[model samples]
Target: MAKVNYPEEFAGFAITDTKDWNKPKYITYKPKTFGENDIDIEIECCGLCGSDIMTAKGGDHGWGSITLPQVVGHEIIGKVVKIGSKVTLHKLGDRVGLGAQAFACLNCNRCHNGNEQYCANGVTTYDGKYPDGYISQGGYASHVRAHEYMCFPIPEKLQSIHAASLCCAGLTVFSPLKRYIPKNLPNNEIPKVAIVGLGGLGHLAVQFCKALGADAYVFSRTDSKKAQSFELGAKGFIATGIDGWEKEYFDQFDLILNCAIGLSGLNIDAFLSILKVEGRFCSVGLPAADEKYNVSPFTFFGNGSCLCSSALGSREEAVELFNLAAENNIVPWVETIPISEEGCETALTRAWDGDVRYRFVFTEFDKAFGTGSA
Candidate 1:
């Protein structure tokens, strides 16, 4: 094993100011104190997520104001270099991945019930504070120290770059599909699932829905992503930008997973009209705080549908997602950029401009951080 100095101050590209968030500066800062249940990972790569940009831009965008000099990449894949005395889940040299969450009060009912992602006192991977007053940093750095439970073993068949985004985007969609879609219907009936939008989350949602025995479909404003959606196992594509697009699919879906970043001009009634009676319209994509679905009691009066949203998934769901991905060869559409200040800026800028086909994953961490093992 190559020796890591494990510097007291970790280096990363940080958002020093909300006004210029895209221009993250390379800087070194102290991480939260390592604890009995904590493990240190030498970052191999990290995935760029919409939440990272939202957090970088600050409160007005709805993700809330972040502490200055925050390192903000949560979809992290790395090798464990250090483990706490109480850590039994992982050992040195194990490749692992962590998503949006870093810590949760393990004693909580939610945690005990396999819903740790919803723990009220949960701490996010970045822009979060530990109980001892240390601000948690993220994987846009040489190393990340997280609780053992938050770290998941990466499947051998899943490449680090490919597995990185699965930490967040894949889990976000997988959790909802696993919860709403049942396995093995009495007549081998496959659930009909519609993924709204065809971006990072939606693309993964389509693959997972198909992997889980659902007949997945894509709903996008235009035909731009229609062909790719079919390639990703989508059974059908609906060009929602067209007038009267919802007429033919009335009450046809079992679930509609909304993965659009914003609900700004969405036709809620039209979407609801496509769901079967008691079907669900679940939003996993979080838009700006001010962007909301204009729905009321009458909105669901037609088919008695339910409107809901899912949080980032739990550890169990993450493990299941990785295993399922390995078995089904579920690969996300990703573009890679080496980790650097310039790379961070470009990734954030293009993602904000809706220029990425799917996700951006940072690579070449050893070249940037000199933390590669022998």
Candidate 2:
């Protein structure tokens, strides 16, 4: 790739130091070189994700090391401001969203095989290295640049704020549910699908499971989310804190998607026991580093269940997720904060502390950074 001209400046809410996240500073940055297949989106709203908080807190998040002065928000909903000459997938003025991925070498086997999330040269939305030596920045800004293939056009029925969370949190669970959950099971005997934890990802998982025509059940530690879970179309709610909860639901689930973030106090064995023979269990949440799940060979072999992990889904899967959301009227429960230096900081801090009801979306980018290229 050839070096391209760098823009004079672009404004974004950024944290200069990894250790100090008291507040983000509104500052200008030199954006990555524009590519022919890239589209520059003027952000409307960006959702606060757990990964963003984890990155800001400073640690190596499996994929790579954290970089300083990072603009961190990947669940982005925006309007297309500029499109590269060769970009034909989307046009200027299109409403779209970019998820955890920003770019992937399309020539790679993974990219060509409809598994772009596993691309060897995958570039994340933030904390990533670009081909032109520019560090990949994220959507907590006035504008964001991403390959056309990574951008999915938001459906008209889906509002920008609501579409924001689907970019990452929704896709993280939706992809695995689509891949693992049984589709042809009878209505009476439809496989029971359990969502572990009722946080951002799990809450949306419940809605998606119902939309996909499965029996959606929430497995939470407390009964706090029981009423809300049922209201969100869940078939039932299982509070693990209740005595003999595991025994009550033993061997009941055909597929279990664990959306819980940490494994420090998780009863992995109890979760595994709920799955019937040949059941599938997949985790999409970013657990703490060094938090291990230990399973005995007998426990593993006797149940004949499969365990795995999922990351963000492909761009095509993202489009399908948005379509499903629109068709089913599925909207995430989000608290909106105006997009400003202080607003960004507040959202991040609350999200870090796990205080948000479900998700937080930062809006009003035009007022925050002005209505220009930046």
Instruction: In angstroms, give how far residue 275 of model 1 lies from its true place.
Output: 0.7
**TM per candidate:** 0.97, 0.94
Report the lDDT tens digits of candidate 1 across residue range 1-374: 22334657678889999888899987887778879999988899999999999989897674777898899999999999889999999998999999999999989999999999999888999989888878889989889999999999999999999999999999999999999985665687778998999999999999999899899999999999889999999999999998899999997899999999888868989999999888999999999766767788999998889999999999999999999999999999999999898999999999999999899999988888777852
lDDT of 2 at 146: 94
Off by over 4 Å in 2: 1-7, 60-64, 186-188, 372-374
Candidate 2 lDDT tens digits, 257-352: 999998776777778888998898888987756567777766667588878899999887898999999999999999999978778878888887
Best by lDDT: 1
The alpha-carbon deviation from the true structure for residue 63 of candidate 1, after best TM-score superposition, in angstroms, is: 2.2
The pairs that clash in candidate 2 are none
Q: What is the lDDT of residue 187 in candidate 1?
A: 82
